[model samples]
Target: MNQTRYPELAGKRVWITGSSSGIGAGMAKILAQQGCKLVLHYCRNETGVQQTLQTVAELGAEVEVVWGDFADYASLENVFHQAWSAFDGLDVLINNAGIVTKSTALNDNTGAAFNRTIAINLQAPYRLSTAFAKACIDAKQPGVIINNSSIHGQQTCEWFSAYAASKAGLDAMMKVMAVEWGPKGIRVNSLAPGVVPVERTAKILAEPKMAATWTKTMPLQRFGHVDDMGWATAFLISDSAAWMTGSVLTVDGGLIARGGYPARE
Candidate 1:
């Protein structure tokens, strides 16, 4: 947690999906302050998207927003291309837009729930990373793609099979792309987050005993914060982490490190 700061990211072009709320909103605020031109993406949350753009504006960074459905890739292409045009080049892509659903197990999952969960959580990031990385490579520019995975990627909750599996798939893909794109000057990595306090997941935070149990459970003896995630992601996407790629950094409160991984085992 020795978070030193640097301004090497000033004037870079960055795109972040799922900027409407939660970790994405938090990261947008931090990255905007670091002097990056931002391309904010939202799937359906009009109010959340407005809030994110307002927050970015307050930071005084150059910002633009686009609307596209994660289930529809063609709708998203123009957003990135326009953002790339506006900024001249794209330097970073944060595939943070994902949806989580509570289905007891794959067996218990309704066909609709199962399909939607995988499409948004797993397929969205995979598709966007491919498009963004291809554009960067074709342009012969160096870039970074940070995928927002979850602690459930390595572990899992009983009813979170679809959600956890999606994240697991995302991390698995990150590993392959890191190797495939390394020589091409592109970096791809994923982050597995612990319980981060957020309005959407405030239901989880309201249960103090459960939250405490989770905290005392991790090796760090605490949960994580969105700001913590922001800093870790900022470092990974920055020049500071240039030597690292194909890495799945667990920003969990050492939850996976302490070893409760059954899903991945």
Candidate 2:
């Protein structure tokens, strides 16, 4: 953690949404260590944001915090403005705010949950990235956008209709934006994580039986850690990936590669 993998990241201004806890928090910590000035956003996790603020501050990273409900939709532009104004301007925008809604296609006939999931997971990022890109273009500065997408975008299972659709849409939008904005020096990419246990899933995923069963399907035979996603995020925005854009980086321990087939007898 002490090593700075990307020295060029130092002094870069970054804004990360939904960074109060979980994978977002992990990404914040790593970016802070890389010497990036940060604008951390949260919806309702005040306490979680405080912890993130303190941790990053201790790491000597200049940081600020903003809050907004992505479901509100209309207010998202204001939220992005708040984050942008925090550091005068931002060099990177990490669209990581999303909700995972698991529901069968037939269970929720009303599609209320699906709409909510799309609003927060897909629509919000769309708006934010648009705003970020416009601002960067107006300022005539290069920028980077990293969408914290999911493996569900490429492949999914039952009870993930809404989650899968949102992520899939996100990936598609990311590619279009990368293509449209690449000429303007705005790079866009996505990180598709698989089975990274966070606070929300810690209890269930920690069970010996559940852990073993899930891990067995992965080629690497292990669940992903938050730090793993964090490191990948860093790399996506780093100089090492300077030529990378409009692509999805899958850090899933080969789960998707193993396919949906059952293990060998």
Candidate 3:
């Protein structure tokens, strides 16, 4: 795919969490092509993070990788601070690290799984966004924040209650942050993606029947690609979307509009 270089993004410092692989990695590559300096974060995927760094560097973009566990608040804070200082300052923050535990029932004996999900998906974003905003405000610099939300935030599937709740909370948080930070020249928004085939969803998509069902139900008759999400994210963080904030841009290939249409038997 041909890369669209956004002149406005050139030299802008960006920090993306969970960028070792999947959507975050895709966004990192795209932004790198746009000439943006990137600080990529990963939890434990050192190999994946290194691979992403190599890929971004090949695009002639300045990039750095940081490791942190979002489930730990103190670790998360340290990661953000290190990233903020990596490039002297940060112009954008992408809250993308999240976890979705399969077969997570609401009444499961232990609430451990549920708590971890909320902590990583919702709490991490909340804390990181506040830190990013406060730093921007203190420096009197304009900034952008994009939360990597999910279509599940609005529509739920079986066994995804905790994940959905976390995403929904994230969307709500974005709106509130936008309202409170917009006046300070900070923009906050959420990008709710549909079924994008990435490392995390490879198992689900490998199920022939399930994959076919998604294809049939989506109006576009196909699953979303990582680059598709990457491009949308890049646009949102760009000056082109200067007038937009507190909005949840759904990149779900018309799945939500279909309202869960039944797949052919």
Which candidate's lDDT is highest?
2
Model 1, residue 108: C-alpha shift (Å): 4.0
At residue 213, candidate 2 shows an lDDT of: 95
- For model 2, residues 177-206, the per-residue Cα lDDT tens digits are 999999999999999999999888999999
Count the clashes in each prediction: 0, 0, 0
Q: Candidate 2 at residue 93, lDDT?
A: 97
lDDT of 1 by residue, 120-166 (tens): 88877777788888899889899899999998888886888778888
Q: Sort all candidates by TM-score, best to worst.
A: 2, 3, 1
Worst 10 residues of 3 by lDDT: 100-109
Position 19, candidate 2: lDDT: 95
Could you give candidate 3's per-residue lDDT for residues 125-214 as a string of tens digits?
Answer: 999999999999999999999999999999888998789999999999999999999999999999999989889788989699999877
Cα lDDT computed for each candidate against the true fold: 0.82, 0.95, 0.90
- Against the hidden reference, what TM-scores do the models get? 0.90, 0.98, 0.96
| lDDT winner, 2 or 3 | 2
Model 1 CA lDDT for position 177: 94
After superposition, the stretches of candidate 2 with alpha carbons farther than 4 Å from their true spots are none
Error of 2 at 149 (Å): 0.6
- Evaluate model 3: give its lDDT: 0.90
